[model samples]
Target chain A: MEVLRLQQQLIELTNSLFQEGFLDDQFTQLQMLQDANNPDFIQEVVTLFAEDSERILAELTKTLETEPIDFKRIDAYVHQFKGSSSSIGAQRVKAVCVDFRAYAETENREGCCQALQQIKQEFFLIKSKLEALLQLEQQILAAGGSLPVME
Target chain B: MENVDGDESQPGREETGNLQNLLCGKKILVVDDNRVNRIVAAGALKKYGAHVECADSGKAAIAKLEPPHTFDACFMDIQMPEMDGFEATCNIRKLEEIAKESGKIWHVPILAMTADVIQATYDECVWCKMDGYVSQPIEEEQLYKAVSQVLSRT
Candidate 1:
């Protein structure tokens, strides 16, 4: 009964994430790759995404704060961020990064700063939701229940 | 009692299993400067039963190609601080040439792993003599297909 309850919670949370545009088909593709041998695959990837995103965000903030801003370097950082976000299926974060790169390309200081803030907000929002979903998965697994698969 | 056979029938399991079989006992090197990317790539490769090694830079990757360390293939990331993937592949080809001259005859396949999915980027990889290409956020099937294709050429 506990397992069923937790599974329901996970399913609901996952649905909400998709409905909210925080994720997309890529996330589903990611989940499809997980298996009994690599049970913690999603969690591992998400953890890496979180760590890499935070570091890139910090570097971006510092880069934008400097005088005679180096748009090339900023673009490089944003490119890395886009790769990581896209890899993990953070659609919203990846979208913001695309916008960020456009600003970087034009050397638009104000636009770059705005994109950074938007990226940060989207990244944090998804990160928290993913963490919550992962926690629910843990509970279900602890109770010897398998994760609910979405079609 | 709830039937838990769902996990067994999850999508991509069969393909993943076949790929794992193809990679079993293979010696592969994962070259990347980022710790997270290294971990993710290595973890996925290791799961497929490959003996995976890590090189944080292109120079280190070249060094590892020398005596006492041999690999069947390498997954090289495109961007790094000192030497990027293009330079690295060129250097690796040089090493291969030297080995061939010495009668060692090593033809290790090197795959370019990157997020840049433009036609120009792929053309650049081919120009650098990389055996194949795999994009970032490496998926199991993509990794398997790339490695398989490269190994087939050798």
Candidate 2:
């Protein structure tokens, strides 16, 4: 019963993520790569994404505050952030990055700052959601239940 | 934990998939400055049975491509710290020229792998003589098509 409940929770959370546009098909591709040979592949990749995103976000914030603001430098950091987010299939965050880049390209300081805050919020939202999903998977495993396949 | 699926005809295949064996026995080099991208790209290639190796930077990739190269193809990231993909590809062309002058026919196909697949990036890749380009967050079909395109040409 415990395993079944966790499995139900897992499926619901996974579906919600996809439905809410927090993730995309790329996330499914990431899941597909995991197998017995790499049971923790998703966990490893998500951890890396979290660490890398935080660093990039920090750099963007600091660069935005500097005088003679280097839009080029901020764009580069945001570009990296965009790549990593999309690599992990973070759809909403990646969408904000697209807007962020356009603002940087045109030297729109106000737009850039607003987009930065939006991107940060989206990143944090997805990060916690991913954490919850991973936690449910862990619980299911502990109860000797295999993860349910997401359609 | 019993092996339930007994469709064990292809013994050498790395993972379970219809796409298995598409890149069997092919050695691929993945060049990227970002660690996650390297792992993700390598994971995708390995799924199709390719022997995937990685270089964290363009300079490292160049060093790996030294005389008597063995990689069947290379997937190079366009942006890096010291040496970008275009510069690396140029340097590689030079090396190939040297090899050609010595009467050794050699040209390991190079493909540009970038997150930004804009027209400008594509134009620059062609300008640098890259064989093909595949955008990042690589799709399996797209990657396979690009890899095979270059592999068949060589």
Candidate 3:
């Protein structure tokens, strides 16, 4: 009785994510890349984005106090962070980088500091959403079902 | 001039001024849960000669309306707590319909501002059919162009 309800719930969660724009076609593509061959591929990648972005943010923070605001160093970090966020289809974080670079170009230390805060706020949001999606994947598996195809 | 605060290169003030021309005289709304972004964004928009307003989240945005109250365009930051941009966008569409009046009541363009920019990001923008987008840390020209492009057709 409950199993049917559970399946329906999983479907609903997937759809909700779609409507929310939390999961886009690329995320669907990520889901598609998985099969019995690699059940955890999407989840693994999501975790990696979560991890890598944290390190870049940390690196950027360490350099914030440099005199004249060494923008070369700062842009390098934003560039790297942009790449990682891009890889996982984290649209928001990468977008933040576009503005972040402008802040660096202007040597706006305060702007850069503020940008860092925005980046952190958005980075963790993607992390949690992907984590939730991964949990849903687990639920589908536990329910004696295959991964849901994102249409 | 009245609104700018944290920008460096006071000498580059001219450069910033050229950048501001992108949104010249435009009416804009900056939606973000963060106050700092609100301040920075409003300042940027004002530099471009834009009239700007700020809202913390989707809910606050929905509740905000001063008569003759309409922006030529809106910049919405996704991932806000309480009510995120996607839901807010959808809801704003509804509100616009209810608040509709003559003299260009058809559409109000909303430019999505986000820190994440990926294929997923593009897909979401498409899915939402947003009028425009400017990624976070927000470039002066890019932000202005996105707003201008959306506003021009309207």
Report the number of the highest-DockQ candidate.
2
Ranking by TM-score: 2, 1, 3
lDDT by residue for model 2 over A1-151, one digit each (tens)?
Answer: 9999999999999999988989887788888889987889999999999998999989999999999999999888887887788778888898999899999999999999999999999999999999999999999999999999876
**What is the DockQ score, from 0 to 1, of model 1?**
0.23
Please report, as a value between 0 and 1, the fraction of native contacts recovered by candidate 2. 0.53
Off by over 4 Å in 3: A66-68, B1-154
The TM-score obtained for chain B by all candidates, in the order given, is: 0.85, 0.82, 0.75
Global Cα lDDT for candidate 2: 0.83
Q: Is the docking of candidate 2 incorrect, acceptable, medium or high quality?
A: acceptable
Taking the tens digit of each residue's C-alpha lDDT, what string does model 3 give over B24-108? 7767788876553454456546645778888888887766632246677788887666787877877777666665764445456
Per-residue alpha-carbon lDDT of model 1 for B44-79, expressed as tens digits?
Answer: 677778888999999999899763356888999888
Per-model DockQ against the true two-chain complex:
0.23, 0.30, 0.02
lDDT (C-alpha) at residue B102 in model 3:
44
Q: How far is candidate 2 from the true structure (C-alpha RMSD, Å)?
A: 6.5
The number of clashing residue pairs in model 1 is 0
* Model 2 per-residue lDDT tens digits across residues B49-86: 78999998888998888657889889998887789989
TM-score of chain A of each: 0.96, 0.99, 0.85
Q: Residue A138: error of model 3 in Å?
A: 0.8
